[model samples]
Target: METSASSPSVSDTPPGHTRIFLVVVDDTEEMRAALAFACRRARATDGRVALLRVIEPSELQHFAFIGKIVEHETREQAEQMLQRMAAEVNRRSGHLPSLHVRQGKPVDELLALVREDPGISVLVLAAGRGKEGPGPLVTACGAGLGSRLRIPVTIVPAGMSEEEIERLA
Candidate 1:
């Protein structure tokens, strides 16, 4: 499916059931820990997963064509990545994962997604396990003392095995 500004989700929800979705912010890495965690939660709750990938804005604003091309490529990449992740979720949890591609700031786009789609139950992220600190998205969402997200945020730490993630979810 062609991705729009707010890309449509590839849903596999039961016809009558309202889908309660867990929105996981997909970044540079696979973040397998978070994916497994979200899938398990979705399976147990009879919901689904939405893998969201945001393309950070480029500094190249001189020409509109460059921005469009970049966005197109980014969307294609996100779709392929989400397809692989969806297969993994289906294999692990028997649920088809949905793909949501957006542009601009991660936190802002996430909040916009929340505002646009009430089906989203929670936002999941992986804590940066480096000396650098909790990842930008986590920190941007006010990870520590001041959590700003209206919806609950789940931050899975690094080194969590799939089994541990399964247990946590």
Candidate 2:
């Protein structure tokens, strides 16, 4: 479905029965772990899941000389990675979630997906990884999506043990 900047989700939800979740992940420990929890929780709640992995255009542009080659390669890699994560979740929770990968800004693409999918009632984000340094800061930046989206967003810390996260899931 086509989505505008003003409106991100494009589908309609039922009055009160359906719950759609938008879970964004990247190639990070926190993102994977958080999604694992979110997947389990979604399964228990009988909610539909949309797993999103954002591929930054800038990152792709930097290697423009091999853009075509790298783009397809990276996309495949990301797809495989997401599929594995989803598989793990399915193993634990018996839910196979939908997956999507887009080339653009992480925040912008995530917000757009949320707007386009009307079924989405909540957003689940993984916490930043590592100590208070550049890596953690960059990863944690996704938290801004919570404040930006109209739906409620749950942010899970990256450091949580799988068991700890599964309890909530």
Candidate 3:
């Protein structure tokens, strides 16, 4: 978890006081839509944005040494990606977002983060446009995983244009 040390802890905030829009950072195309929606919504609500990047464990079970190296490289890559995305979030929301990196299944990590961070008022996701279906996280949310979360989930359509998002968010 690479959060800003200067910022007050969300757990310290009174209930219903802090509004942090939490968005999962991933390589999928719909991720951009989710990010845009979260940023715009945060700006509109005078809230902050929090980004969570979950690093799935490497699948090199046969080679312990190789798995360690791969895990280190993966963490580094996730950190770099978070830095780049944080800049974009800042540009869009006029504030730098809190960055977090966790190692586990995406759904589990997301749930844990929300449970741990009291300031995360909303979980923003984007429905995929692919013929297959919405991406894994969104699908998981729809498959009863969302009911386990303490915060509301917001799903943005992947094909929504900036104009539409601006008007709605």
Predictions in order: lDDT:
0.66, 0.64, 0.85
Where does candidate 1 stray beyond 4 Å? 1-21, 28-30, 143-147
Each candidate structure's TM-score, on Cα atoms with residue i matched to residue i, is 0.79, 0.75, 0.92
Q: How large is the C-alpha RMSD of every model relative to the true structure?
A: 4.0, 5.3, 1.9
Error of 1 at 117 (Å): 0.7
Candidate 1: C-alpha RMSD to true structure equals 4.0
**Candidate 2 lDDT score at position 103:** 80
Q: What is the C-alpha lDDT profile of model 2 across 1-169, one tens digit per residue?
A: 2212122222544625666666776666676666766777777887656677777654556677787787777777777876776676566556556667788777777778766666777777766656753233234455454566778876676577778876773
Which is the better candidate, 1 or 3, if ranked by TM-score? 3
What is the alpha-carbon lDDT for the whole of candidate 1?
Answer: 0.66
The candidate maximizing TM-score is 3
Give the lDDT of residue 86 in candidate 2. 64
- Looking at model 3, residue 49 earns an lDDT score of 83
* Over 4 Å off, model 3: 1-14
How should the candidates be ordered by lDDT, best one leading? Answer: 3, 1, 2
Superposed by TM-score, candidate 3 places the C-alpha of residue 147 at a distance from the truth, in angstroms, of 0.6
lDDT tens digits, residue span 136-164, model 3: 98899879989999999999987998789
lDDT measured at residue 128 in model 2 versus the true structure, 0 to 100: 61
